[model samples]
Target: MEKMKPTLTVIMPAYNELKNLRGAFISATGALKIAGISDYEIIIITNTKRDGSHDGTPYVAEQIVKEDSRVRHIHNNSYVGLGFKFRQGIGDARKSFITWVPGDNENIEESVAGIFRHIGEADMITSYTSNTQVRKWKRRFVSRCFTEFCNLLFGLRLKYYNGICIYPTKLLQKVPTKSDNFAYMAEIIIYLVKSGVRYKEVPMEIKPTAISSSFKLKSVFEALGTIALLFWNIHFKRTRIKIGSIN
Candidate 1:
């Protein structure tokens, strides 16, 4: 008998991405189909402005949920961090594995399909952008610096720390993450990798989008603080425990 394919739960976080939400959903579904993943579901987490206003993204997400039974929608009353949205999706995921795609339509269909194609080959699928020239100079500089800093601090050589990664749902749930901001994924990756979980790195390419929420001064400072705490926790505070041994 042929081997059964693994099921996946895709978490899409949309913050004022009215123009790209539907396209992102369609692209993700298409990529999943291309990768031969038939048993999968998408969870769209929609966010609005601090004043409880949006650009109709929530409505668009609702339409998607209505059009597809595999799609689920979660609306936030105000703007919450990306990490918070992902944590919510992770808790609600009902599949064997979990991954996230941004609703900004930055990730190309081929890259997404490539990531999914490597599913079940390792404990996790970590991706790195092959074409960094697509981003602005400042953003590229910041990203490079961040990746280098993470590698130095963690004593590992990884090309990227914040790309779209796939992890087992139960394993991710068992690991503890404290950051609810953009730096949350970095924290999770460091924890899991340091704990000796096997992972595979894949290359991805992204398209430039109209809006970017990651380069703000506030977000930069928040990420720095979170990394500092994470460094301390990993190097000094926590005991060395392998992820596979976690209960």
Candidate 2:
């Protein structure tokens, strides 16, 4: 007998997380085992050094995959944004379902498995924090402000825009995105909702990681611009299509 194909693909992108990759890989594998789902694959993407120079992360990821048959690695020669790495993983995935487990291990292990349970009921599954407060004051303040601003501007009611999301890979492959920064995640969600795809939300625990990716002021303006473009495209183009009733 031969092994069956995987039902899910886990995309874990590691930039310079060689030290954390081992733990992240193990935690992901453990969650898969606890979920009782054997048919899945993990893609560890080590794009490049943050400064676009050579680094050890890619080599470390290569070694990890060599040790575990379930794991695999991709090392892009150039440094791309986090969203770009995700797009690469999405293109490389071979499973029906896909979810991102950030290299920093922000998602709790138990909650990782629970995401699979929601796939049966929705096309896209996202998460929010269970606790009332975020531990880091700056992160909490920025997160709240971003979510509120986006919801108000886009006419959505989502609690957290940058949290974990589990997507039907097929649908994701078909949708087009215009963002290459952190806003890429938001672009996908907004498209899904406006396009009438069924989505669900759940509460999950977010653990603090050893590293914090800088939230730059320039990225903020870029995201805001992406949102404006999406708003115009969705509302303006959608109204025209409805009037024409072009299926």
Question: What is the lDDT, from 0 to 100, of the residue 38 in candidate 2?
Answer: 81
lDDT of each residue in 11-54, candidate 1, tens digit only: 99999888999999999999999999999999999888989899
**TM-score of candidate 1 relative to the true fold:** 0.96
lDDT of 2 at 148: 91
Error of 1 at 202 (Å): 0.1
Q: Which residues of candidate 1, in runs, are more than 4 Å off?
A: 239-242, 245-247
What global local distance difference test value does model 1 have? 0.89
lDDT by residue for model 2 (22-105), tens: 778888887787777788899998776656775477887888888989888888888777788889889999888888887876
Local distance difference test scores for all models: 0.89, 0.76
The best candidate by TM-score is 1
User: Cα lDDT of model 2 overall?
Assistant: 0.76
